[model samples]
Target: MNVELSFMLKKMLSVALMPWSIAILLSLLALFFLYRHKIQKAKKYLTISILWVILISWAPFANLALKPLESSYERLENIPENIEYILLLGGDRNNRAWEALRLYHKIPNVKIITSGHSLHDPISDAEKTATKLIESGIPEERVLMQAMAKTTFEEAQHMKERVGEKPFILITAAYHMPRAMKLFKKAGLNPIAAPADFNRPEETGYATVLQSKQLKNTERAWHEYLGILFYKLQGKI
Candidate 1:
């Protein structure tokens, strides 16, 4: 599939699979059934919808879902030898860039590859991140931008072409590391997972059950799960 189309499909699926979206959709269906005078079915659907909303809104539920993905790869305490490049996948740009720069300081000789396409901005994410690295005193020549890639699969493909058969540290959100590693490996690149931007959740309690942050975290976890499934179906990983 075309990269842009795949991205769009992923976005659509994300919204569709989100806890809020699914709840609202189910509620709408319940209402539709009620309008048609199917009272029993309407009540059943409404019950299911409410239960789902409650289940996903709970902090523990979301935390349980996200924990595995976030913990899929632990942070590397020591940067390994012969790592020729540091590939940073785009998400939270500034944080990822900062992490990339920190890695650069540890291994000043390795090239840094920032990958992302433009979204709602004239400056592509890769270019913007590369500029940030340069501004931080890293030589401009050491930063490579793969601004054409809009998704993890595309990022893997582009990086494979640029750093073929070379081992590199793969940097991305901690929750995103698993899928990124799978795609990069499938693309025939040797990737050392270097997950960053870790957001450890607070202890789960009754007060956190309906918190907006928990809801957002649920959405993030669901997005990664959906992305992994999509990649599997497409044979990209």
Candidate 2:
């Protein structure tokens, strides 16, 4: 499949898999069943649909679902010796760039590769992040911006082309690390997972259970799960 087409498809898939989209879809399906006079089936579907929305929106349930993905790999206490590059994937999230900066501070000689494509925005994510890194005291010479990759699979491919077989730390959100690792490996790059942007709650309580952030977290978790499945189906990982 063409790269642009794949990127668009993945974006569409992400929107469709979001919590609100899934809830709306389920509710619509329930209505259809009801119209067909399958009362029991309609009731079952409606009940599940409502509960699914509520649970995903609820903080406790969302956190529970996200915990496994966030904890899939532990954070590195010390940068391993001889790592040449720190590969940061592109997203609106700032934690990824912060993580890259942290690694750069630890390994001052390591090159940084910020990869992301220009979607609807005039500035590519890579360039945006690269600028931030430079402003944060990273020398411009040490930062490389790869502005052609719009997805994790593309990021792996581009990184491999730029630094073939060289060891690099792959930095992304904690929930996204698993899929990122698989794609990087498939692209034949040596990636050391450097997950960041952990969304885990520090404590659990009655008030925490009703927070709106849970809905967003659940949506993010679902996005990763769906991305993994789609990538597997496409043989990208």
Candidate 3:
């Protein structure tokens, strides 16, 4: 079953990156060659294989999936003065939690929902986030932690259930906002976005071009976009 799943994932990756026409053509050629030859033919496929790997793994292409999230975040004016809670998605260490917690402090009487998957009993990220907030002087009673959610969909679902009739913010990486918002919306949560850790913010011209992080950022962006598409196809998000 693991082998079958791996093979299916490999097929998805190849189909996602290569155009349908090319994949079909290659499949037909591969089938033709599979008829009688026990030994694999010659080596002409290596160059194409290398190019595909490079394109799939490289930076700017990766951000294809993440850019829309970045744009959604840039559209907000100051934190809406009436936010009820702030939902911080877990995955990062101190930085992401701190950034969201800062906002949690700013809004008057704002509750916080920190969500993550806990592999251990006593070491949840939700607890870490809550502990940090309490140390930061926010009352312990005001912070809420949702620790059972392991994936974005489950995180949003948990938040939606907890957030009954409340306005909240979804804080995550700029590259992740697009898919995060989509999932939250689907889960029936109208969480506002508070995206952080942007590689670039409103800069134009050659600056975006020459920065090393741009490529890195773009790669991350595309990964999320690919994930969103995959989830959509699977009806998981």
TM-score: model 1 vs. ground truth = 0.91
- Top candidate when judged by TM-score against the true structure: 1
Q: Which stretches of candidate 3 lie over 4 Å from their true place?
A: 1-42, 53-66, 91-94, 120-122, 201-219, 234-237
lDDT for each residue of candidate 1 in 112-178, tens digit (9 for 90 to 100) = 9887887678988888788888888999889888888778888888888888988889999999899
Clashes of 2: 0
lDDT-wise, the better of 2 and 3 is 2
lDDT of all the models against the reference?
A: 0.84, 0.83, 0.66
lDDT of 3: 0.66
**Pairs that collide, model 1:** none
lDDT for 231 (candidate 1):
84
TM-score, per-candidate, Cα-based: 0.91, 0.87, 0.68
* Tens digit per residue, CA lDDT, model 3, 1-237: 674466567556745654333434555555555564622631233345444444444445445534566777763448877888888788445378767666765788888777776755677887877787778888878878888766688787777678765768888887788888888887777788888777553334332343445445645665676768877987866
What is candidate 2's TM-score against the reference? Answer: 0.87
Candidate 2 pairs with clashing backbones? none
Clashes of each: 0, 0, 15
